[model samples]
Target: MTGERGRGRVQAVAGVVLLAWVVLFAAFVEVGNPLVLLATAVSGGLVCACAVAGGVVTMRLTDAETAARLRHVFVVLEGTAMAIFYLFYGFAFSVEPVGRPGDFAVVVLLVLSVPALGALTLVLWRSYAVHKIVVDAFGPLVPDSGAGVPVQRIRVLGTVLVTVGLALAVSAMTVALVTPMYRPVLLTVGLFVTLSPVVLGVSLTRVTDVYSARRRNVGNYVIVLAASGFAVSEFASGAGVAGVLFGALVFGAVVLLVIAILVVREFTGEWDRPWREPRGRKVSP
Candidate 1:
């Protein structure tokens, strides 16, 4: 399918999903005992709907100028959603009288917000405005028809920082899960996890279109790193520190392999061409 058509389908699906979530939250509100769960679900659904709506609006812009304006608006909407999640659940997770069910819902919502906001920002900015800006401003920095060496170096630095942060956070979470005395440490770890994505999001937006090939490579790396962190946290919680370390090592290895593959692809002329055909009007990129 064409990119525009695919985007339309995705927006439609997002709308349908948001509607279903609204209905589900409404039903739970009427029948559930824990008010916190109902409130959290309802708020989360509204935020998601807002994000989806922003995406739809962004997709409607056909020109680069209009798209840039819409992208700015979308970013503001995303920031608002992030603010709401941080203020509500980030603060309430410890003090709220919510039961385990409500607490689970809160945690899930917080996690979902990161990717939902990330995807929204990506779709909007990566379309044209941000892409053109990076391409025009840093075109000389990018390698000819390949992943730029400078961009790759920056990505490497980002990967290292993200890896270290994830490691420390996961280690803290594991200890908290295994020992009741470390619960405060776990809370701090959760805060770190929440903040890391926010920082990554801002950084990514600033460098969204630095190099098309490197963008995909960097995104893939981030995903692997995040998955690894989750695996380590879960394994540690379920088994022991040995299990967590082993899982983390495995994940780290997989990410390293992915990085190697990306680097090889860059050098082997595999990523020398545009991944997608340019469409509409060229905007000086």
Candidate 2:
């Protein structure tokens, strides 16, 4: 479709611009004593830009349901690429006893290639499963609109995954906080756990365009608060206990606030009415 092609073009241009920015920034920092923190921040910005571009491209090229399923894949790839690139650069330039070429190659391949492949596979599987669900559940209601029908199911599943992943990631962070110094096992597990929530959270946000805008806004607020608190906690003393506790409190408060808002909206007719439509109606998916 012409619309899809236009969106793809926009995404490609945005992605190119972001990649260029990242290269320029990295080069600028290379002249100075490159700090790991600076590298990470810059890399993170690039990753975010890439994620947005990927989402836009996916949304334009695929159906809404397919895009929802692919959201996690794109997020994971962007994050993994950013992390691997930043770490490689930092370790090579800053850390003493520079890693061997083979070792660096192996690490880069594992971090970038494996995760990219895994995410792509997972997206394909989820998409197929969502397609089947839509065909079975809403085929009669909207005979030709396969894409819209699967969107709701995708959203529900994505939200559930994100919530579960966040809980696990929090648990992992608790362990790391208790341990203080980074053990290889704990660090690796913590990183994976953290990434899980990130990937799933992005997917949830993408699917939310179909749902309650209020819920989406609340969720975004919670995510930002939680992320900022967690980042701040890393700099705290006392093994970051105080920071962790503060972050946890914030997260809990946000969760409670979101629930309250949802409850009030439900009772006050502020909630969207799509869920109330007849089961067989051709409501927005």
Candidate 3:
């Protein structure tokens, strides 16, 4: 289908579904425990807001490829949100339901979905904005096929690793959600699996001359530290060490803040300051 028609249909469908969800939520909000209902309502609202915002952005983009990618991303996100809500309601009201198992699931979905939307937006923007700049800035640094490894191979390897890792992570999450008792182990494995590909991809980008190796390494290290800290905090929380969990959480937050700055700087050309020097400046060896 044409991009325009596709996007219009997506927006219309999303609007109707979200509106129906809102109406149903309003009708039943008073029937359940107030706190549980409140959490579900808020999470559902956030999902709807993100879906709408993503659709709006998709509509505004002039690039057909980018718009299509955004459309698919938001569709998957909205569908996943709806599925989680359905599952939560079904189990919560079942005759032999356990004590609020779906509550944790809904909260986890919300926590994961918001940042996922943001990351999709950021990555899409980065791909479009930096494509030509990266080629011009680093094309000269690339060596001939006889002298060095091919950039295409590096990119392919990175893509393969990322796809495989994400598949594993998603599988882990699926199993974890269905079996709550194994959630801690499954989630921990998924976290590391998801991140390992990211680390490997960043490293591979260095060989492709897309970004400075030093800066890439720095960003990768910071993110790894943050992930480690967060993982440790989860373990601490399970161990009942409140202080350890609090300290690790704070450390991860600070590390993430630093990485966020680095990401902004990388995109803003701050990391390329030396590469973009005046014509007379000596080029890297």
Candidate 4:
């Protein structure tokens, strides 16, 4: 009993620490903070190791065998994937910190667009799923897996994001209505950021197992837009409009980060399996 309790504690701590990993990576890519990515990856690895060991030792039921195997893979993959993703973004910057948000935005725009231009590009690349980009570029470094995400989990996560987004939208709108402290451009940015998650959540509804790829693809794009993951120091350092924009950006990033975490855990758990199958059909391996 004591051993089991200890293992549960370890797993809980590991989960909390994993959130820090997502925040760092999101900030790293968004703001080009190299230090945040490195620190979180290294520390996340140590905690994940403890979590994996505890899980393997304590899994007692026969039906939980598959879960034990999956949990083990996901924990290790989470740590390793952190390092790979950090390095992937590292290629985007020089030794110097980014001087302007515009430049960073332009670079991201290009990266996101590259996967879509021309025929050959489309053939070599299948879907624009963010994981596909990482795996394709890194070359077999991370295996492409189904993630085997269930319908309910996806909907639940999306619902939570929508709820938070609406809350932020209301608060920001209230502040804007009360006073005209912010520039029109800044207010527009905040308003759009607030709505992005709500839109993304709705998109998830169209993805019921064997939905159209185009519909699901659009959902993925919305997820990326919600966070607009760029460096936030300049926008985040203000008291009025700046503060509102900063809060919106942080909320968006959290939404994106959490979704990524859920998908990756499922992706790494089930290797070489069909992602979503049509009803009344069995997918061939």
Candidate 5:
């Protein structure tokens, strides 16, 4: 199928099946527990939102000839994932008789779905925006060997995301070192603790866009793994004096130290060269 028609077909797959799923759910299921009802409503909303967003972004792909490969990728990932997630929720909650094991499953799904869907939404939307800019500027002849990244490569969105990740990472480390007694900033620490993965994921993905293929994930891996270790230390904060002092403070500082060493290693070597030219700093391609 042509890209335009394919876009339409993908949207149909999302909208039609989702609408039907909601119908079947309402007709057969009984929600005696308020929590189950809430889970159902929230999950339904999330599934629909993700599907619509993925569809909107994928539809833009048809505007750029070079975007065909991207269209295929998004179609398969979004359509199949949303469909499967919805079905999983459906069968898991249908409750043959209702309310036996929902407490744990509901908690797990709710916690996981936010990041899962949010990450998926961000990727699709950003890809479309990038594709749209290139199609507008250079008539879709952009020579991209992988994904349709434009030559000009002006990446404001990516820079902002990575900057936020750095800010959160620094703030979390600072708050821990200053002691948790600074409860006012505890929320910020919690944010870093929870959203670090998403931040790191987006940041690293953006980092790769500029780096040489072989070295793309090297420095990013150190940053992400250190951040994750630091975040996981939060759970031990309740273990008393030793916990508060050693859990986040000592461990976090140690991880940051390791990160510093790795980053220094990344920058000093020629292995990490061919980095993206910063704005106005022309590099021979």
Candidate 6:
């Protein structure tokens, strides 16, 4: 309980800090329009709300498992909020020379908001179902199998991401092939995005069986890579052709950090055991 409280405090602090940073960033950009800044602030506030909500749920819940699932819900919410904020702002910066920021913001908001809405709906529906089941059960809902399990929910999310990413990647590649101004770096970005989801889906699927520690570690690394790719891609898009090398450099640094963390964890014996105790069985100490 003490640990939970500490984590919650940390999340609260993070939310405050993030809100501050967003306001500072908007001021730094010298955005002339008050509405643009207001929109940015609202997005930041939504993220802060998500972060604070996650911590509150974590602290308030007695059941660790349900709390864990709820945390995932808030995490998705935070990501979705931030993604929409970034996509709109990033596209605004990336728009063609003659394009107005107002027009770009409107178009990008519509484009990004649709998928975010669908993703949020799925997350909330699944989370509600899980909460209902767990609450109605006589004891802790030990998810040994089936779609009710948290792992199963993750797999479903992964599957959806992979399917959508693959389709988008294919379409992007087709356009790149026929277009004279196509950038290879953009294609690489699409491939990285697609690969991350595919790797995550495969890794999580494997974990459903024995839940190997190494497999989990690898999955974590893939998640880091995916996040790095996303951040880099957004920056690259905004920076134009000049950002290709910069994005690669940033990504390479992230990869090295992930590798170093893996090595440290391995040496500390963190990955020397199963991720979870075997179902319906016990390990002798």
The model with the greatest TM-score is 6
Expressed as tens digits, the lDDT of each residue in 1-285 for candidate 3 is 246445644754574466456546445533324443443445445545554555555555555454434543543443344333332332222212125532234443343334333433433343333333343445432322212344455555556555654554465455444544435653564466355655555454444333332334444443444344434333333333333333333333333333333432333344344454235633322
lDDT of 2 by residue, 14-87 (tens): 55554555455445432222343244435444443453455354545445455444544543444344333333
Which runs of model 2 end up more than 4 angstroms from their true locations?
29-33, 45-49, 52-221, 224-285
Q: What is the lDDT of residue 184 in candidate 6?
A: 65
C-alpha lDDT of all candidate models, in order: 0.43, 0.40, 0.42, 0.42, 0.42, 0.45
TM-score, cand. 6: 0.46
Please give the range of 10 consecutive residues that has the lowest summed lDDT in model 2. Answer: 95-104
Worst 10 residues of 6 by lDDT: 263-272
Error of 5 at 92 (Å): 8.6
For every candidate structure, what is the RMSD over all alpha carbons to the true structure, in angstroms? 11.7, 13.4, 13.6, 12.7, 11.9, 11.6
Report the number of the highest-lDDT candidate.
6
lDDT of 6 at 204: 49
TM-score computed on alpha carbons, candidate 4 = 0.41
lDDT of 5 by residue, 1-285 (tens): 255446545664665455455545544555445444444545554555565555565555544554544644553444344333433343233322345532334443453345435534543454344444444545433223222342123133334434554655565555545555534444444454434433433433443323232233344543433343323333333335533543343333333323332332323232222334346633322
The regions of model 3 sitting more than 4 angstroms off are 1-6, 9-13, 26-37, 58-198, 209-285
lDDT tens per residue, model 1, 169-195: 565455455555435544554434433
Per-residue lDDT tens digits for candidate 4, residues 1-285, read 344445445554554454344444435465444543344344333334433434443333132333333344433444343322322232232112356532344444243223212211221111122233233344322233212355555666567667877877776666545544443533565567676667766655444442332234433443333233332223333345545455455455444544544453343322223444447753321
Instruction: Please give the RMSD of candidate 5 to the true structure.
Output: 11.9
Which is better, 1 or 2, measured by TM-score?
1
> For every model shown, what is its TM-score relative to the native structure?
0.37, 0.35, 0.32, 0.41, 0.36, 0.46
Clashing pairs in 2: none
Clashing pairs in 6: none
